[model samples]
Target chain A: MSQNLPLPPIALPGQPLAQSPPYAAGPGTYTTQNPTRTVITASVAGIPRVHADKSVSVTRPSPSHPLLLLPEVASTVLARVTRLNPRQATVEIFAIQGGGDGIHGGGDGGCVCEHTFQGVIRAQDVRATEKDRIKMLESFRVGDVVRAVVISLGDQSNYYLSTASNSLGVVVAHSDAGDPLHPINWRQMACARTGIVEERKVAKPI
Target chain B: MTDRRRINGPLEGTIPPVFLTSSTHKSIIKRSPTTLRKIFLKTGLTPPATGSAFLELPTPSTHSTPTLKLTSSVYGPRPLPSSTTFSSNARLTAELKFSPFSTPGRRRGYIRDGVERDLSAQLSIALGKSVAVGKYPKSAIDVFVSVLDCEGGLGDAGDEAGGGVDVGLMSVLATAISCASAAIADAGIECFDLVAGGVAGLVLEQGGVVEEDRVEKSLEVGQDSDDARRGMRKNGKVTLVLDPSPIDGYIILAAAAVGYMAARDELTLVWTKGSMGWDGDSTDEVERIVDGAITASTGVRLVINEAVKERLLLGLKEMGLIRGKAVSGDGDAAMS
Candidate 1:
């Protein structure tokens, strides 16, 4: 067996960052066509394309492809859990990078999204045994870049997402001085500007 | 990939270019306009004061028998655009339609498909070089082509009963641009040249094909091994046909780069013979058949003119566009 192995990641149809299957990466332009099959055609000059219209900023799907026709998925997120009351939990999330669905498809639900999450905490996860579990109330704070997983379709009217897993935690932090912080141990970092103790993720083990 | 040629034509069975700078193909319809049973004039079916024409050809009734016919209409010359090349010339528009039932199966897709796009692009290129596009800058002269009827039999020999859109073939040049030119003339667009086009192909027997090696690679840091284990391979060779038939492929096209309707040619060289899961290794038999097919298809240029064009124009005008004027004294009899 290979040593130091972790979970397997599926390689997308583009150039691989680390390593990927040779066949998956073709030697040509990867159109929004079938992300699977690569197609090539003549390059006619001066042909007007409909996608050039920017007022709508719509990324129309390829006429042949149906999958990408909808909005794109969110990638990186930043937010914090606040006021995790037993009966009701209110977690306010913020967007460091807005990875909303592409091509005019936005919102988790009908309601416009802002910095907040309000929902019922799972009854089963109400136990305050583990540190991150009990501290789920104080486990998060302002200015913390925490990772999240979509617990449910958050957008009853808006998009729903949560970062309640162990592997899913904060990645970066700033001290009172608003300077970069360095990490030494898990869940903790030393602010370079003020030397204050800050909490962030040690980074995913893999 | 280079394709092997085989002997084709309704007389014999089985199938599937002469290119110097690049390869080009033409489809040879058995009987063209000249050999057609009756002679037809522009004013026979429609008045000269109006636009367009359409025509029909006869076919065998039974056994592997299929029919071929052509129709066309013309429109044009309202204004001009400086952005175009033919500031003093005219613009032409063209379209081709293949009925769903025209072939073995139902055609699919609402948007223009790859093949359709290629055909459209080719038609535009072939006609653009001939028409005074810049003459009516910003304005277009449109021509539409539709395959009204296609039978099982093929003009190219190698074609089987079940393939292509209609499992039938067309006179590449005549069918491609016949309706196109008529539509222009119907629209009254003026230009220096009239583009003509056709299709013809070399036939080849299916031979043997060999597979290549497997490639290996690692997955992403957190990627699953199952994706690789599931087994995936390349899409395999792309099937190509030069002036393909119904079974092999059907391509009707044309061009006019010289006169008001002169000859401007285009070239294509992709060999799609064996991509239909019939690749061959030894090149001898394939070579012989292809040679014969090319030799026989040589007369396509003349065939398109005599067979497909004039007839289609008359028909289009008869059915949709204005009718032809009577031949001199036949006005009363012709109208009846």
Candidate 2:
């Protein structure tokens, strides 16, 4: 029955959707071309929707073009830690999750492009409880995949990221013996093959 | 570095400059002067680019052979480099290049000149307005245009510097704008609307008055700008041309080009050249020039709409949603 739901028409940018006053503009919609006769038009190539509140929007259609993977504030991202210092850890964001509809085609849970974005995790953003005691070496290692939230599109070169919550931190990591790590505690991860414990800011397994 | 081989210039003194001008071969203009030359455009030609398009405009007299040919390619929406400042919106860049053989005479160097740089900057600004740059933040999109042929015989007869000839620049920019928009759409980059570029010029009206005006202008030797005004104010008209060529002989008092988004009825870029009193609070002349440019752009937009719709139909056919028979109509054949 869900498959029987009719799909909305695909809209191109600049296509007129409706007259204003009765229907307000929403995301992917804009009004241009004058001091007279204001017309609501789609600004992105996507599917048009008329919400219950009488606002119109255009959501980017999925399954066509290669997804444009970009990170914005408050969005969860999966990234790999590349370098570290006492002050901050350098990371590269690889994927994004849980934004609204309009991203698709990367085979992953959400959109992933061929390129990656630069990100950083400052020492102060590693945990909420430990304001100053968190060490970069103990929190993350090179090649560890960390789940974090984007705090800000950082100054020029990197997107500021934080792994301060219980659900956010190193989700996948390897021990020195090249063994996969399993969470032992909030601060330690155990390598089952080597029977050795390593320190990491591990995320709670569901 | 090893020495690189280069092309040789034309031999000196084999043909005198006077012989070149005395051939009496006036360019053939077959249609009403205001109509655009026929355009032949096709998309998805460059496999390496995310999207690509090829465009050709044939001389009016020719059957199916193009006198102007250009190609455009679109790339990226990829990550921005770390060295550049981060922007909340996507950065758009455009580049235009003309092959040495594109002109009629002297070969051009491969290095990008000042004119190319200026044109590229204008092109970027024109296209940047039509694209929804905010949708893909922290990224860059680039459009590349290459001109294979040009009108006006620039660089011909050992004029390697390309001095004193600017009539071709407007035509080239107009073609590049329309071509690049199609390439972007082919690349699947989301845009607010497609931008079509057009050109128009102010010329003397056709009549027996040419002889009388020439004699009167010769009698008044010192009033050059005044004479130009007399042509417009008394016996001149604006000819809206979508893709203008230098071969057509016109007084060419002034010319204007515009980048228009037809669906929204917006003018994204307006550029006027020549001294027709446009800058001195002459709102009447300025508005007339702009109006002609917009009318020309509207004609070009009709062609663009059909081309884009054809692309969408091809996509549907490839997806098996439409029958192959319905997709076989070849309306895009070059109508030179």
Candidate 3:
């Protein structure tokens, strides 16, 4: 399918890839408008490919590509809760979901970032319903790994995160006895070994 | 006062032996004014850094000139420090340093000196323009370059006649700019273009009179006769040389270094030093020197393009995307 597209074996930064009329700019490429026409140029050194949808992109080699991922607004992330307070839970963002494919489309699994960024999930954003009745301790613990969506780029210190959806909450947790907990429902998790139940904002099984 | 912590050398010192024939003080190599020294550039040398590169200019056959060696590492697109004010675009910072033993005769200090700081600022400005900073908001990119070995002496002591221009430092700065740009590109940072640095200088031949043989050779090489004549009349037979080296022994009158983007036809940074006249009548002279620097930059850009492509090709080959023959074929293309 990509045979008909005029592709260079490799592309360097600022190398013009194609014109905008036939192909739209994709990842690793940007468009610039001149007096005569718009040109799509490669922004990184990689192999340029033209997608089936008439979009051109320069894809770096797979191994080093994950290092370039960053957490952006409205994107789902996998974060490990590092600290908890009365009003909020601080998390360290470890992986980004859907990679660079919008919010819902999955592109080659998720990209695991090389560096973790600071994020905070406020008490009110723990769930979609009953915002005022939520407790930070019961919803998330310091060691829990939570699935969250970035709501906004908060203050200088942390990225504002939300786990308000049924699918966006604590995906992993441990009981008081330190046994791994399995989700029994949206709000509770039961330990398989200790038979102890803990209250958490649990994510529904996929 | 003398230190008491360690044993010192004997108080009575003996005179060191002196060689009858010293080969180190030989004359410098001679080349055409338009020719530049060959550069060897490679990227991805430091595995720990996000991206790294090494650049070198080999010592001439005479071995009088020291090899110019530089290493640059790039970090980030990572988060900024919390204490800093918020910004909408990515901030780029560059730091250039010389290793203690990189220079001859004297050891450099651990702390950054005024020259290092000045070069760092210039390097930042050169690289900042090529990067698409808007793509990475609220983050910072840091580039660090260390002069592993240096060409030309690192100090201003060498060019006492040049007044303000330090030829050795200018060459080092130019090399550092190119090295940092390669590292940035290797890091996969989004950039509008790759910036290559070049240096050109107006040199005054030792004697006031222009030799008959030299002028005839320059004319035969198709160099502008008017420029040669004008410089002779105005500034004691000044000659413009691309990629001027301090080891050449020529007394430099002025020098210009530029960070040029070949594809975009833009110059990101322009630094000129020395005694170039700033008066209205000397504007053409300044333009001519800058134009010579630009031409030199275009030559360096070709080497950078090949270095980047070589790394990418290796990556593709390792992934089994191309066969061995194709890899060799591409390498041949680059050489040609």
Candidate 4:
């Protein structure tokens, strides 16, 4: 059966096959109806405490605790709350805005780089990122522009994202190579030459 | 006196019984779930012009009670259009599809939705990096996907704003890489290294969750480039999960591999451990999602590596890369 198989360049744990170990549990510890986490939790041996949290969850939940979502992802993808069931609410992000909006709209207005970020806003703290929220320090609002990196191609309908970066953002009024445009600080920032006011991500170089 | 016996219940619409548990608090408890045998390498298993593979995923644990099952397929390594095609390079096209019965409710039809379209594009980019396209002359390959069944937290059903569960997609892409590698072997196509794909989704808790990250300068940094994360996320969105069935997003993370060199220490270690991580030491589930995605991606990368090895060995056997030179059977010929 393993004849025509693709052998590993470097030996991996489950060398013969990519299959998992089948099972892992320490009697009563694992039998709990819904433990806080999986055996993978203990597997984080040498990783620093802070870095360890970056791993993704397996199929099963830890019973009560839900997974954490990055605020950066939420802010980037313009997510929206579609439904709120007993346990949680469903947020979906549509078009990443000009200035990068998230499903959570829980951060300051900014862009990651060129891509407009659109965050999904289903539940408040469920998966949004706090670390990113602190950096941006802003709340998401309806109509506010947003954008996001398509984190992953999820199951059927929902996609995953992270606005954790500064570049991926919404483009409110995108300017071109030489498009005569002005910021919307005032209703009209009359330019000395053109005397025209437009909406754009005006660079206010500090 | 008539054979027609009408019931009081309206028959216009019928409700179908569904099975596929959601995630539970206890992850260590190994329960007997459904078998996803239909989604694997053995199935049909062939790419059109170049490489192909199938992605098999255990049921998702996001929604109801964590008994989700999924399967994905990838195909590609063909030729490119004259304009887009490189002189010495091959081209790629990716396709992602979901079965109507794959989800909880009746799914939308055969139409390739906008989200799926975008995802396909991303898959192309994600795998493009590892493929030795330049080795091939004017050829294009296509990647195809089909989701058999999705349950519970398996994926997001929220299409309100054109976002879907990304976890499944990434998982499938990883699987596809495996299949593609196999096909590439069958076809004996050259490549830098097989690129692996994985899902990294945040199952956001309600507030109060701290998490963290990597040293690799993000190919796509925030608030930087004009294309922003687009170049970095050139492939497209990877799914993010808030609570189980609650919130979600799409952020795509591709493997930065050029035949082994792409995988770093962190990624290598995680794969060496044998298991993909779901939780480390943080209350925030998102952290695990991030790390999990990366680690799982490593696993996917390895899978691709194996496929590449097989493909290369076979291709070389066919092309005679490893065979001894045409040694003259006779002594005179040998001398000449």
Candidate 5:
């Protein structure tokens, strides 16, 4: 019965690894303490990894595995504009880009999200210049995909988003004639099939 | 109230009652009264659910041991109802139901009963402590538990004296807590820890005799109304048993059960039945009982971790990242 067997690196939620001063908590890890010691435990099911700085973290075995990702302040997100009101444009956030790599993990299931986070683009956060005269309907359509940065974890129901930078704004949309449109300017897009120009706060393409 | 399409029970014959009594049926395997029945737990069985698990506590003697079997499913961290006002924390809900044929007595109704409702509330409270609710604000997580088989009836412990322990309810709650935590983990819900539950009771000895030796005497005393009962009330000694079956001869002076987070050394839920006296001197007795229950939960926590790790290994094997020939039952080795 004595065979050399290596331990699997997997860590389940709530599993404790080591006491904290020597091991700082990283992503997928959270710290808790008793009267005597501070302990680090995995918050998600994944493989436990120790970094060079003695900080410990857990990472999913596969990148494609489904996991719920919450939108944090200053994180870039991909969202579809759902509707518009006088003060803000309502959007549903579907994909979150990581802070370091900018790698996107869209909603858990491919093309279908079990849970979609709500976000909002306020008139003031839409562009850097126009804080007073920005109209929600003119800047974003019902089905436009917008690249935005989360400004704040807004009210209970939504995250506040901003697209004020030159690189952020409408990434995809359709013209009134029902054709794909490309950005023609910072404020407009043109349909290739009909050559019809439409008003939008367009983003710079990479 | 009158739906002709619904099937009804027979109206003619008088049915027998099924109580949680000591079994007369002889078991093939002989075990000490203190040993817990072996537990078998597996996760990810229900494909449609976000996560699911099945649990079985089987004894060697098929007919004599009261079998406990259950399954739990977790559905979401999805959007909340639109009609509700905004909530900053994730809402957690649990529902527990017994199948119609799970028990030996009358079939259960489709609607939830008071017992089921109470257990559901307790389950939700126990699980809510471990989940990272603040992370998924404005969303809700739903857990549904179904008892496929059970050994006792609803009124089994209700009519008993204060010194009596509700073994059936304790077992059901303990199993539900363990199973639901696995399903939540399988669903990939972020949690600070997985909670494991266990039950323990204080065995009160009489005179110079040990509690186990007094089973026959206590049974005979139960037949006599007043004198015998009063005579047996004096306390001599008390010992705690981690997992006590109904047949255990101990007169349970106090019983306690808890949902324990082993890694963090915290308790999410603590349920107590019977009194450990109201006097200040009895504080140590109560603490001792609670500590015993926590130790039992650690044993259960080990088993829960093994089941979860087994699933993780299978997933790794599927990706060709790990070898497939590793033995699955190497329990203690994997844990250490």
Candidate 6:
């Protein structure tokens, strides 16, 4: 694959990088098939790299490529709870875990976006064990930062997110006295300054 | 008979200030039909935009140089409005506007008029096909082109005497298409190919002798004697010129602007205006005019490719991927 063509260090969009039979297309690259053969081309202007596994990809020079950081289905996102209703909790998604990894890995592991996207956590999707007994107020409150996974790209306005797993719930919250809350267990958080225990869905510490 | 409510100007009418026109204005310089005017293109001018570019056609030595300046900015692949229905592809929109002072004599209105709307639609058509829209589902990409300055032909007296085609606007559209394409490429939008625009026109120079051989060639096309006589009576030598400027002082018979993708060998948009049925077969004339425009676009494509590469080289340098000096040579070495 390396001997196929002398690939330019930087490639413009649509510039062919490698042949598809020996190399598969990866991120920042797409394949186009003609009558004779399939060719992998750079989809963005960036440095084209050929991986050890014979996969060809392009890495954008700028780490903060804005549009490429969009959240997709099954991606873990960190969002702040903005509003609460009888059946759902509205959130503004601020960060997305890079590569959709549940664990926080080192070096470029996540993307913190400038503009937030809207999402919703319905009462039914708050937890997995008790579907009918979930209460929106007890599970989440306004201004609580929660970690969740996108389940569906719902309607025109909001993405449907779920916090059903033990590792996906409120990571940060405040007490009624405006003190920071620390998670004590799966369903409670205590403010050290006020010693006021609050009921909430708590994510297990990584 | 008038009640005083607000302060007003003096009761006596006053004459407006006037200034002398510059005396250094000169006629357009003659260039070959295949040559294109110099173009200066740069990307990433507007910091707030996802991508931006500026284009200028500068004729420094000519006193009466037509000011052709344009800037384009691309925003989004962001979320769509709530009112729009769900879509599996990104929605692309383009808007072209002329600033109030873009033209020389007459001022353009802030409101979008028929000309701006028409150019915007044509720009949208020119850009829509090249983008890989399917990859960005339920998002919107908007391209805005602002014509900062242009050749003064909007309300020129010469336009009425020449053919009805607005050669100035055609050239503006062509430049705008190229500028917007550069901005889109800078935005890192996935596309099959970059689209470059070009314009060509059939110009009739007055008092020039028509070649007898060319006249006989037109006659051989099976046109009636009456048509041949009419064609002969229309005095002047007709020549197809690439990148025609209205400042050239020639009567433009017909003009075509094409948005061409050189790599794919495809034409995304073709706009032609003016009367072309006088001398030769109309269909063949149109085809020739379009062919000329494609040739001009291919020339523009080379410049666009160089500009894109220059920016990429700068990016790679900043990222420390390639070391100082000998940038191009080092880029290849580092990648390999």
After aligning candidate 1 to the native by TM-score, how far in Å is the CA of A25 from where it should be? 60
lDDT of 2 by residue, B132-192 (tens): 8887778889899999887634322443221112456787888889899888866767678
- The numbered model that scores best in lDDT is 3
TM-scores, all models, native as reference: 0.31, 0.76, 0.87, 0.35, 0.79, 0.86
Docking class of 6: medium
TM-score of 2: 0.76
Candidate 6 lDDT by residue in tens digits, B1-336: 554887777879999989666422233667776689888999878988878889987545555567688999998778888788878788999999999988776678899998899899999999998888887777889999999988764533353433325578888999998899998888877777889999998776545324444444554563675565356446456778899776665556788999998877889999998767664688988998899999999888888777877776666666554345665454546555
Worst 10 residues of 5 chain B by lDDT: B327-336
DockQ of each: 0.01, 0.26, 0.53, 0.01, 0.39, 0.50
| Residue-level error in angstroms, candidate 2, position A107 | 13
The lowest-lDDT stretch of 10 consecutive residues in candidate 1 chain B is: B251-260
Pick by DockQ: 3 or 5, better one? 3
Window of ten residues with lowest summed lDDT in model 4 chain B: B207-216
The TM-score, computed over Cα atoms with residue i paired to residue i, of candidate 4 is: 0.35
Question: Model 2 chain B, poorest ten-residue lDDT window?
Answer: B327-336
How far does residue B63 in candidate 4 sit from its true spot (Å)?
20
Residue B157 local lDDT, model 5: 34
- Where is the poorest 10-residue window by lDDT in model 1 chain A? A41-50
Off by over 4 Å in 4: A1-206, B1-44, B47-51, B59-88, B152-156, B159-186, B201-292, B303-336
List ranges where model 5 is wrong by over 4 Å: A1-8, A34-37, A52-54, A62-65, A100-113, B1-30, B59-66, B154-163, B203-239, B247-253, B275-285, B321-336
What does candidate 5's lDDT look like per residue over B1-336, in tens digits?
Answer: 656798966768877987685542222343443556578899889977878889886542555556778899998887777656678788999999889877655677788888899999999999999998887777888999999877544335343422355566777888899999988877778789998888887765544335435543664657763333344444345677776544444567678889998877789899987666544456887888788888778888888898877776565555443323453223223334
* Candidates in descending DockQ order: 3, 6, 5, 2, 4, 1
Cand. 5 Cα-lDDT: 0.74
* Model 2 CA deviation exceeding 4 Å by range: A1-10, A19-27, A31-39, A47-64, A100-109, A184-186, B1-26, B47-51, B59-64, B134-138, B152-166, B187-191, B204-242, B249-251, B275-283, B313-336
Fold similarity of candidate 5's chain A to the true chain A, as a TM-score: 0.81
Tens-digit lDDT string for candidate 4 (A31-93): 112244323221100101111222211110111111112222233344443443433234445
Query: Relative to the unseen true structure, what is the C-alpha lDDT of residue B214 in candidate 1, on a scale of 0 to 100?
Result: 26
lDDT of 2 by residue, A6-70 (tens): 32355566778776777777766777555776677876544566767776766532224435556
For TM-score, candidate 4 versus 5, the one ahead is: 5
Task: Give the root-mean-square deviation of each candidate in angstroms.
Answer: 28.4, 7.2, 6.1, 27.5, 6.6, 5.2
